[model samples]
Target: MCWINKIESIFNSTRCSEEDKVRFAVFMLKSNALYWWNVESVAQPNVLQTMSWEEFVIRFKTQFYPRTAVRQMEEDFLKMEQGNRSVRDYTEKFIEYSQFVEHYVSSESRKVKRYILGLKPSIREFVIAMDPATFSLAVNVVEVTERNKNRQGEEKVVEKRKWEGSSANFRSSASFRRPKFIKSDNYSSKQPPARTCPRCQQVQQETVNPNRKDVTDAERQVIYQGISLYLKGVFNAIHLIIFGRTTHN
Candidate 1:
């Protein structure tokens, strides 16, 4: 469907909160951008009966990004399901509804992005599908992870390309030694070697320069370990590179 009409419908929706509306909107926008917007994905990945675009889109989101979209859709349904039902009586039903959706949180990207946008025609034509309590819950996951803060500094997406059997960025970047205290406690207290990466297994004793134009194999490993640390939540730190600050729960 036209994107603008969908927005009008949601905005006029009195039952949903402001947040659900936005979440539904985002879900739609992202879905259209990914699936219907792309051609090859149209034919049935499954039963290929020359699927109508809408039927294919819904099925795709349900099978793939259901957590992203279906979970929210389910939430919206449950809230309505319970709107007339009493909290005291329908509490168990509510929990069941939530559990049903949460179980699918890890659905593939196709489904997940659809959920994020609420399946608008532009998007939904791609799982266009939301409610009051449902909308609140939509933001809750983001809040639990706390990914909603205003960004600081530059909004950047660093792309790493593979080259010559090593990540090009890691292979060529200079290494930064940790401070003395970190070195002592974690890195075996070795003093920073003058102008060279001591961690590298030196072979044939070529003159190792810390400022070498090309990083030795050791530097690439260091970069890999550093990324692993970030993903593992080893520490909450604000690098000037990401957001102004890295937050931890």
Candidate 2:
């Protein structure tokens, strides 16, 4: 198949005669190909001498390329879809496979319609609306559509990231500026003064009793003053520690 394509390219470029094309192709055949040609020539004597380039191609393909493979190729081409392939890749395969099914894409309109039908639904809808008259035009329209679709997807992603970033910043700022309790120096003054326990009063009465001879009056008075001062200091310290600020009144 590759050799035949090369020969066709040479003929197109050099404007070679049909006889010359056939002769060149036959000369290039080697090994098993050459052996096959020899056997063919024997089976049908002087067949090459009168054969045109087209006739020679048909005979060559009949010998090398089987009918079953050609039929399978045609069937696959008819059922071809873009699926996950990119527009350009699908287009290339479509062209390659179309060669085996010439009748399916014989006209430009037929080829364009077939190509459009095989495209992804999103692209196909727009292309059908445009109604391209040529196969090339249809391909161009779909390629542009695919590019625009991809660009839109990228923009949406960028926009989503920007929104998420701003939300994160807002959350962080709100946390940083949150209000906290303020300590005041006069907080203790708002509450009533601490009360002395009944037990302390009873002890004081016992210490100052007239019958008791453990201490003199002046010494009892001094001890009573000391106990009262100690209790006052303890209550004041507890209030200051718990409230963070306090005032003496």
Candidate 3:
């Protein structure tokens, strides 16, 4: 119906002649009528032979959208919910169903209330907190909030992927360019050769021993020599005293 209205508006805007507009409308309707059995039957040569565009639309709408169907549409509108659907999709669905009873939902306050009631809980809370004055304002706020949330979620995912990729690349490149272990000729030359002489080796062994005593060979020899010299001097002094006494008697 909206598409038909758009075509009609284009014809009016371009100032097409009434005869041309009628011809175009009839062609479009007949061309599409074959797809639907009811439309094909209703759009027969005799029924639409003398019908105008307005008359054809009225008849078509009357046949398809009866009073019962319009009442059901109103019920559907009342039960509509935004659950899991995007705000734009929900809005389009609500508007399409509400068209059947636009007279009742004409007021801004009523429309706003109905729209807010159908929104998903998360978005509804934010919108109500904002307390928009008009239905348009409510829609704008909800849409913006949902878009921002979606954008942030996408950014987080992208950041995580970038971090993972960078870490993997760093590991791969580090493995490829690592410095190899090359044995240098000068490495062995820099270390001193081990001592081979018996005396030097023994000294080295003693120096490295953890349990060796603290006394040295030079200190023991000095102590023994001093005792021998003291004994010899005492014996000579005794002999000299005895001989001198005997000669005096």
Best by TM-score: 2
Worst 10 residues of 2 by lDDT: 202-211
Return the TM-score for each candidate structure. Answer: 0.16, 0.65, 0.46
For candidate 1, the per-residue lDDT at 6 reads 50
State candidate 1's TM-score.
0.16
Candidate 3 shows a clash count of 0
Which is the leading candidate under lDDT? 2
For residue 106, what is the lDDT in candidate 2?
Answer: 94
Runs in model 3 lying further than 4 Å from the true structure: 1-27, 31-59, 133-135, 154-249
| Best-to-worst lDDT order | 2, 3, 1
Q: List, residue by residue over 99-202, the lDDT tens digit for candidate 2.
A: 66778999999999999999999999999999999999899999999999999999999999999999889888967677986644343233323444587643
lDDT of 1 at 116: 38
Whole-structure CA lDDT of model 1: 0.42
CA displacement after TM-score superposition, residue 86 of candidate 1 (Å): 19
Q: What does candidate 3's lDDT look like per residue over 30-103, in tens digits?
A: 43343442454465756444656677666656755788988888888888999999999998887777667777
True-vs-predicted CA distance for residue 101, candidate 3, Å: 2.5
